[model samples]
Target: MYVAVKGGEKAIDSAHDWMAEERRGDPDVAELSVPQIREQLSLAVNRVMAEGSLYDPDLAALAIKQARGDMIEAIFLIRAYRTTLPRFGASLPVETTEMACDRRISATFKDVPGGQVLGPTFDYTHRLLDFALEAEGLEAPEREAGEAAHPRMPRVTEFLNQEGLIQTEPRPDVDTAPRDLTREPLELPAGRPLRLQALSRGDEGFVLSMAYSTQRGYAKNHPFVGELRIGTVPVEVEIPELGFAVEVGEVVLTECETVNQFTGSKLEPAQFTRGYGLVFGQSERKAISMALVDRALRWKELGEDDKGAPAQDEEFVLYHCDNIQATGFLEHIKLPHYVDFQSELELVRRLRRETEGRVQQEAAE
Candidate 1:
């Protein structure tokens, strides 16, 4: 058993004070504002929101500032703060089909109903570091805004569904509320909804690693990006008095849908299966990684042969996915374990003494 050391209150307080001063840096330097972080460090804010399981940009930005740009730390702050917030009524699910897409692309098809809109992507940009950015107040060059090509672009999966080339997704009851792991404890052998929620809020690095493993032939389910889209979708809530759903607000989301290969079986026909990923904000990498991992987890459900892969192991992935939990357990080792160490030390010494006594007795004999 680990016991905390006493009489460190003053030292701890002093350390905290020093940390605060360090976080602020030089007095002459301009302080970073929450708004600036929210707008400028949008990706960091997005990641914090995704991992923290909170959607507020301002709060996430504030956490980022407080954590001194440490993403995992920021996520921890946001998650801690989120627990104190009062619960509002659950909002109706946003319709991704009706999304006002900013960036939409498909690797499976060259051309679709709406053309591939490469909106605000670094995909084609050179990796060279721009020295101009090192200088302050440099304005980014802007191009003329184009008119919207399509109001509601058709999903790539729909095209496959039309031709019966892919497995059809069974729509769940719209009114039925999905189980929230935040409110209730996570139970083993979780349903897709629960698993998805966990994965969506999971550590990006962990999910990415699991996804990468599948790609590297650990659990090779040949996957192709059916479509990846980043856009704002309207969030609606059913008004009790009005008895109708009204649009409350909108949230930016990155959605990735993967098409994976499945062999034909005696009972089931050979068709491309779908793996879905939806995360808050413009996180293509996280979203894509999530999709791949989601597909890998569904191997048992999909009736595929289990290859004993880590990604396929639900307990292993789910238990280790949360960085906060993982970090907390790992960081706990720094705490004083004096009693435990002392016990082990005594046992070792006793064993050595016993061995020495036995050797002396044998010599005497």
Candidate 2:
């Protein structure tokens, strides 16, 4: 009795055409260029790159444009495109110590090796809209000419490390292979590396909410920002034939180190634990949130009581963190469900008839 609607291909093509037209609104006005989006709307591009797990600024910009500035949709686009690329050699772990830091700060220490360089942050900015920017003749802020180069900044965690106050990360072993989430299905009891990978690419808003829950006494693991640094690090790939690592490219990264308090267990002495967050670009809030969530997830390993918070649940957090998966499932509700709806309708009707018959029999008795 049900007739399937045809011309789906034509409808889809027409929809795409309409979308394209909407994307390029007002032909008379100059079109927004990809380069302009890449530079001017850098933060949005950074988020897309971070969540998309791709580093190309131009491609991220393109994705952003295609998605009509919807960052999650842009990330989905980038992720889809990333799957088509052929796999080359994997890059060696980037050396953050050698990072030419643009912005560095620490909540734990007053004065670190490199003075706190509050570079290009909106933290102190007044929320008031700049109406001047709407019209022409906007002047750029004057820069101090020939400013001194920033001092080589050491990590704030290093100070804690010297006194053995914080837990040390395991030394990198060449033989140890990291579990790639893309290649393998995520299993329970995930290691630090796997969890970090998931957090790095997880939805910003979702991660932020989870992190916020912890602050509101859901699973309060007292956290302090040991170091928050944003900089560019060299990416290197090991050449098998050449037998050495070579610089492939450089990528801007935002790294956060959260030092958390841990009461001494029976076996080990009380030492500060660490939660780390590293993302593709200058996303400080996301990076900080990620650090908090990362530390929360480590509760099981640290032998602390799990308060059964959503953030503390590894399975819950990891499973629902991906926007692509969440969006697809949510959007699928629009698909044809006539058979499903008919079954439900029939069951309800049968239930109502049976209830009426029972009521009549009871009245007669």
Candidate 3:
């Protein structure tokens, strides 16, 4: 005999209480401060900000701590918080050309106008673990006197244009504002720039794996990272009161552009195809992967035939993304569904009995 399921409200309330208690952990143990998490678990914070599209590191850190260091959960927390924030106004598009860079490098040219600066990276580091980190003691590096950074950061693509190695990417009118995805539903067949925004806030592992498959010859996308830059860019919002743009705050970003080779067609000559990436904070991998996928999605725009590949499908990519949406739907399956299941059982039993009777009559004949 099946019992009618009930107490869903009570169950939900108890579950929420339990979650709160779990997040608190042992009261006797030291509680984690947001600042501590922000400083200590920087990488996790960065991942959340990159995927969540929220630049607040403290919130990201709190999410990570509450999630018990689960990166995706932390991302979800940030995304939830992101949704609650009221939109004040749109900021003027950040000028990467005016970015105060900490790290900038290009692969397309031996030397570039920007002058490659490998400011901070683990690329050349040995794989062996540094045992010094095991000890609690550490010394800060000394600051040198009479040291000054470059007055201006230059675009690496400038050098390529000088030699005519690549076509200069067209810059649209800065006045033409972009539609906010959070405010409106995302329509299909978006431009590369819009697609990048969606994918940047997309599932990190999902996007990365898709890009990896393309690299493994699942699709015909060969990418060379033309430039990878990590830096702080000013966010300027035009305030009517101020009557000019003002810097509200600055956010760290990792920007990458991948150069994909293209063949000539009737309309255009062979030019270096482009894929772009931009993400909050130091997320080189995410940024680079995003660029590759961006290019793969642009196959049709560039006059390349659709090879029926996963990357070529815009709906498949955008609709399946967003960890917040994915998690909510997946977790909802655990909720009680007695009404739906009862209907299914009745339909199935009637169908089975009818089929059996029909088979017996046929056998008699």
Candidate 4:
């Protein structure tokens, strides 16, 4: 007998074979190397790294190449690969104040201690396409270099904190270990640390949409960008043998702090609240969005009323933010459902025949 499942297996294999050929594109065109993608299309690689919950630029670039530039697919590839890797000991929290600043800006303050370092950004660029990029071997325009030394820049919040204008971030009396959602299942009524971890690796579009809803008065808390900084921060880990921490390496990070609305009662004076975001690359927009969403999700903790907004719902936001989960559920409908569909078809036909017989009998009477 010709089995349907066996035939489907062969068909799937053939499809993958054809897909491999199609990914290569024109034979005359030069093949793109992993290094080229990592260096040139770094932003895409950054998104993959962020959403994939992994930090290997080379692997991200390779996944992008294999997925034919489909970012979600690349993220899926990276996430799948991550499952096979061995787990290492966790690193200590990186200090952003000591970051080698690439870009730093503040909307609330006119000027900050480190001053505004614009760095490389598309914010001020004209939207017109530059045809110069189409030309082969076009040299990039050069500019004067700045100071080589990386100075310690004080965080903008530190200024507000000095005067006690902003509420300080909560810390446990004892140094409790933060929850890891990757290792453990997500439990509802999660803490800020767990929520932030989910948001850091969540889908950019989903997080951005949730943030946008808050701005559009869904859960309006009147947020202002306190500060946004992007740079490479030194990563360290505690060495048990040495009985101290040692610098392992460095990673590029984007940190955002949003000053939010104040809420106080008879017991405490009103102070400016804060929402924080930290991500794996030069993802300023994502960082800002994450901050806004983070604030919205803190309605209960901040002693504010539950506005019933989608962003304010912890269960909804955390459950739906993962693109892998969303895509898997959404895409599964396209798979074969012959047995289920056949049952439905039989039920419908049987009902139709019974109705037709009843109608004929009524007409005869």
Lowest summed lDDT across 10 adjacent residues in model 4 is found at 143-152
Q: After superposing candidate 4, which stretches have Cα over 4 Å from the reference?
A: 1-3, 172-174, 351-365
Backbone clashes in candidate 2 total 0
Query: For residues 183-294, could you state the per-residue lDDT of candidate 2 as single tens digits?
Result: 6778878888899989999999999999999889988888999999998889999998999899988999999999999997877699999988999999999999999999
Evaluated with lDDT, which candidate comes out highest? 1
TM-score of 4: 0.94
lDDT of 4 by residue, 6-76 (tens): 99889999999999989999879999999999999999999999989888999999999999999999999
lDDT of 3 by residue, 229-278 (tens): 98888999998997999999998889998888888467768877788888
lDDT tens string, model 1, 115-215? 78888888999999989887999887776666554467899889999989999888898778789988888899898999999999999999999999999
Which of candidates 1 and 4 reaches a greater lDDT? 1
lDDT of each: 0.92, 0.90, 0.82, 0.90
- In model 3, the Cα lDDT at residue 18 comes to 96
Q: How good is model 2 by TM-score? A: 0.95
Query: What TM-score would each prediction reach against the true structure?
Result: 0.95, 0.95, 0.89, 0.94
Q: Better model by TM-score, 2 or 4?
A: 2
Report the lDDT of model 3 for residue 181.
69
